[model samples]
Target: MASTTDVIAAPAPAPAKPPKRPPARKMVAWLDPLTLVKTGIRSAISATIGKQADRRLLDALAAPDVKPCDVSVDAAGRPRQELWLDYVSDLGDGWNSTYAVAETVARPSLTLRDETGATHETRGGAVLVFGGDEVYPDASLLAYEERTLHPWTCALRGQRPPPHLFAVPGNHDWYDGLVSFMRLFCQGRTLSGFETCQRRSYFAAKLPHGWWLIGTDMQLESDVDQPQVSYFQELAKQMGEEDRIILCLAEPAWLVSQVRPKEGRSYLENNLDFLEEQVFGKKVSVFLAGDLHHYRRHANPEGRQKIIAGGGGAFLHPTHLPRKEAELADGFTPRKIFPSPQESQRLCWRNLGLVVSNPRFGVLTGLLYMLLAWALSVNLGGANVPQALGLVVRTALSNPGIVLISTLVILGLMGFADRRFGRWRWLVGLLHGLLHLTAAFLIAWGVSHLMGSLVDLPFRSLGRDMLSAALIFVGGFLAGPTIMGLYLLLSLNVFGAHPNEAFSSLAIPDWKNFIRLHIDKEGHLRIFPIGLRRVPRAWKRGETAREPEWVADPRDKRATPPALIEPPIVL
Candidate 1:
């Protein structure tokens, strides 16, 4: 043994390791101002979307735990009254486009006071079921309360005895993650002393009497057939003693727009089958909603009724002009003329259909539309190829300048309704004239596009398009708009309230006028004027005019009962 120490050969003298440099100081964390701005926008958008998703639900009123003593068969199994709510939607100006939200909120109180007067007062307290889209734009409680104040405070307070109020959350309510909606509507208070009931965003409520009000959170999720069906089964089970249950949805588009092609990975249309089978086909007694921002009813060919009452305090919506030439567009059926509903009936039903009440949609305050039109007209010199293309897009999207100007012109055309626009008929005339000029330019641009569609742009056509574009630009720059505004106007006989006195109500019609056209699957170019027609339904996808084919069977009725859902009812 070379010696234990030698054997360890040990530690060749540890080579002096170079002194390790101290770890570098950590960099200070920082936030970019641009990033902060982006975050705020995202937060706001998420909030709005949450409202769209909030479905102030109804609890499963079916209680197997009910004491046997509570059961008493009525002399007649059927309750004395059988109410069928035809349609319900957006009673409170549910959704909001940038244009008309202000008007909706301005007239909140008058909108929500159970206008259709209680169907009937029964021994059991009444169930006031809301179709959906209870709050407009966003589910801001302030907005909801504001709108509710007018309706309830003004008229509903007069009810000898107030009936129970049942509400269904629409997309706007569901938008802000439904937190506010759930807080105000579902969790806050509903029936008197019914605080103990589970405060789920969506649920069912049973009147002391035999009626069951089933409200579904249809907005957060597009197709609610399964949920609706499940509610039915549960209702049927609890319905042993209860009379018929009323199935209410916030938006009627569920059935009509059910077949729409899914856009941006959206499942909106796929659920139509479920809706049709469980709710529509199941013969759910009543349907009510408010998304069209106008009150109207389509008595379902199948006995069920569909109502769209988006006309709460938010804004009004108008039916567009009839297309003279029929062109096949998806979802387009020109209802140039429609039978107007009764004012009282509309009020009772919560639709913005009648002339007694309707908010006006407005235009940009800073002459934005006019300026944009002028820019395109002037810079492009009347119709540059690119400007023409852009104009085509604007027209297709229902150019605002065209709509606003045209509306002014429409008001002028009436010559008789001068009271409405007559206050500034000259100004209105000027605006409409400008609007018409813009419209003509836009139409010409569109025509070029149509021509381009028919024939590839030959060099000559290209040259002509370029020349036209330059002329448009020069004209727009000089005149602030083009000549011959292509626009459509609609009669407001149904929803426009005649102002009996100056400053009686909100001065909207004159201050704001515009249109948003939704060219359906048919070649029908239908306009929903901006201020009047909020186009409550946003992000329309698919061919504007074609009725989609049913990929899935919509009438399949086979399914498990809703009461037996896996999650036990917390209530």
Candidate 2:
């Protein structure tokens, strides 16, 4: 471990030119057709082919030379040593939300009070660690430059001796098989105002006192590769009995294991367990992660901490779901959760307006209804409403394509159902699919009826059929998404299912948070969990040279400052 003076005395690189102001962008609409298709394809490919490719690449290039970079900063002989570091995750979403966090984190100093009203004035971290998912939707050089790098660059433009930056790859970051992540983070490039110094995706950093921060990259929820495991194993050999380790992972497996034990027993969790038992042993005092986009902390009687602080800038995830207790090691439940359950449940109500929140989703449902109508050849002329409805059900059951579509719908819904529900998920999915199918039939019948009443042409007439199809499309567009929204609301609020879908539909840009850690001279680690209730929605160009190009507009009603989510935890 290098001393503090040794770390800072290193020559500073030439400052890069200030980045141009990033264009204002809206929050990612998860249901939008383009977004859905792009992300879906990338995710599918990454899960299949990308994982294999990464394994081959790592085996070829990294396994033979398993040397973990040493970028540790410590105070070896000093009587008083103090270090501040910041950890944020799931960033690179909308402009307003991302900039809100960047500006706050970039500030030179912050004074905040805990619930006990004890004030602490803290300076910005000398080291900044991005937990995971640096870019949204997908990863690419342009996306990183625009969404990730530009914001921070503009925020830390004029600062001298900029902080050092390190990051772990999340699923989104590995969408391109970590091509973009490697170029941006592992090559030792100067990122905006921060300097990057990691030779690989995973890194081990020695902090002041006897603390070690080790970040791991579990590619696409897979096991830790041999190289990464060996790297950490070597680092563990240097640790003394008194030294403590802060293990950073891409996902909070402990939470997952507790919430959905069967599905959560993944190779990543197994790898972590092995590392704890074999390599790091009891030295790992803290486990930090950020796949779930919220803030939660679970601790045990032995003083080990498991924290999830992914609320950097992405859409808010609900923390209100009823999860099983203590399937994790030592039977630990979350000691702290941000946006109290009441508040989270209240926010879920917004999903009821999914038609308004994600109107594009309605378009997709409408298109599906049209396809089903075409397959069924729905016609209302000279037929009673009951007869038309009966034909829809009969044709839907007989048509191979329609049957397959219905099966897929049910299966998709089943997969979307929370794993915690166990076998009940099948019934939930079937009922949910039946509701949509019934809606489609009714919508088809209504459209045909309207066309028949409005025109004298027969049902087979091209003009009448075309007009009917248009009406069906319009009707489906309005009704399908509305039904989905209602279903999500009921499922989440009543059944405690579809928590991700329910909250994602909201695309909420508030209640962002991050973790700030301080290691005192006595080797005690203090954790301050900071949260922002509402991100600034408005901004103005700065007038002075020293100020960032953009600053939160004082007139914006939603511009609330950062505060302690809970009292600081000293360990």
Best candidate, lDDT = 2
Model 2 global lDDT (CA atoms, 0 to 1)? 0.81
The C-alpha stretches of model 2 lying farther than 4 A from their native spots are 1-22, 55-80, 260-264, 374-387, 391-420, 452-467
TM-score list, all predictions: 0.41, 0.87
* lDDT (C-alpha, whole model) for all candidates: 0.36, 0.81
| Model 1 worst lDDT window (10 residues) | 562-571
RMSD of each: 23.3, 9.1
TM-score of 2: 0.87
The pairs that clash in candidate 2 are: none
